[model samples]
Target: MMYQLGKRIESIVLPVEMLQQLKPSDFPNQWEYEAWQRRNLKILEAGLLLHPLLPLDKTDTAAQQLRQIIRGALEKPLETGKNNKTMQALRSIALSLACRTFDGSVSETSHWADGFPLNLRIYQMLLEACFDVNDETSVIEEVDEVLELVKKTWVVLGMNQMLHDLCFLWILFNRYVVTGQVESDLLFAANNLLMEVEKDAKAMTDPDYSKIISSTLGTILGWAEKRLLAYHNYFHSDNTETMECVVSMAVLSAKIMVEDISHEYHRTRKEIDLARERVDNYIRSSLRVAFVQASFQYFSIMSLHRMSSTR
Candidate 1:
């Protein structure tokens, strides 16, 4: 229906109407219908009320009314028959909220479920389609096709190329980590995406974008640094490939975060020095940890040997 309507939904009505138009007979039982109904209603509440693109007006009676309807329906399924009065009231108020615009007039695109973290979560889930479900570590060969199809929803998702890159970077890095870090390719690909994010960070000055980027890169940097600073433990000669990727990612994330996050940031010929200094710190820290571990092992063996001699 959205495509039939030229994809100009611009409101929560799209999902809400679809729910309302369903007949109870469409489900296996009344209980099933009610459960499905409640779940969707929570989605609407999450998308429309909890994390709306526009800051909700606490004084808006219509918003309150919408909440009441959701809250009530969560407890008891609301009648959603085509002629139901409750559905009529919900449709009216939800449409009103969704039609709001920055210039004080409505647009053909609405942002009900497209708020910051929510949008990121949804987009990341979509990007997960690129990974094979049967083997979670393996990216599907059809990833390019899946991504192209996923990009079609960017308008409704309020995603731009920069946001997509950032989200995809996180997905790659996280999937790599979660899958026992065996897919060096995923880590390698994530470092590549981090470079794109670095470019975007340098180009964009929008605070909203910066905030999200900063938070995300901070996480990536912290995780990357943890491993890099303990490379003696985290990486072996066999996995030097992983070490290379982690170092590159850590340096890039720190560079981007430092440059974009600091208002007083000044650029110098320090780019080369940044990597040098970071790698130096990682080496020193890792050597210290390695030394401590070796000493502890040496003392433990010595104690065991002394006990055997005495025995």
Candidate 2:
């Protein structure tokens, strides 16, 4: 019965029409809006809370509710002058996971999918809930649980690239939050996942699915570039370090393309050429940004030195 329910929820992809209707006008006020989101959060929390007692179907219903809540939350804007960034992060993370589910890869989801559904399902839910309910120690405990789940389930889920990519993204988010850094380990994992997806890009029969996968990879790359720039800001005094890190990241990306995604694997010669050109352009743009930042820092330092010497 639970397996049937899991299958049913798995089949329940939220339609575009329903998504279009989940706008802010649907709610009367901020409190009620938050209440609706919290209710969805509770549904997710309850499913994980009662996972051992309930069947997988009920558990999946919780996952489905979480997915719906993410979609609804995204359509509506948050109230002004409130520190709801955590809530916003929850919506983004859950939406990424939701995207994975509906990308058609979940149809043949393996038993490995069942290994820790609750842990994976309630990640962002638990994190946002912690902001409301927990103290420092409790928040740390929740982070540990999510990280452990991420580490354990990561390799197995690579069998499904969509799942693997989003799951890796969740791991990257948590790592950044907990340690204030995106570890090289996480970046390498993401690199491998993107390469794996690209390797099969020519073989994917569904054009929509292939496009979605490519879009997701692009999003990951965007996130990475943003992180690099953010890290550089903090180390503006060390231009060498900034240049090396940013250039190394771009090079790592180019190296992955060269070594893994061969021309023969591409659907056509034109496609492979376009892919190579895109990576080259990305590297050049990244270096240009880095050079501009470095120039600004150098000029700032020189101005400060001149002022001090004049004084």
Q: Please list the Cα RMSD from the true structure of every candidate, rounded to 1 decimal place.
A: 2.1, 14.3
Each candidate's number of clashing pairs is 0, 0
Q: Which stretches in model 1 have alpha-carbon errors above 4 Å?
A: 3-12, 270-272
Which has the greatest TM-score? 1
Off by over 4 Å in 2: 1-179, 207-215, 227-283, 290-311
* Tens digits of lDDT, candidate 2, 1-311: 32543543332222211222244567897667666654555443343234421233444554565556555655664332224554444444333333343334533322222324443454434334432143321234465566555544433222244444444444444443365443444444444555555555545555434444444444445555564544434335735443344444444444434433334353555555644564466557667777898999999999999999999
* Worst window of 10 by summed lDDT in candidate 2: 12-21
Please, what are the lDDT tens digits per residue for candidate 1 over residues 116-175? 667788889999999998998999999999999999778777889999999999899899
- What TM-score would every model get versus the actual structure? 0.92, 0.36
Give every collision pair in model 1.
none
- TM-score of predicted structure 1: 0.92
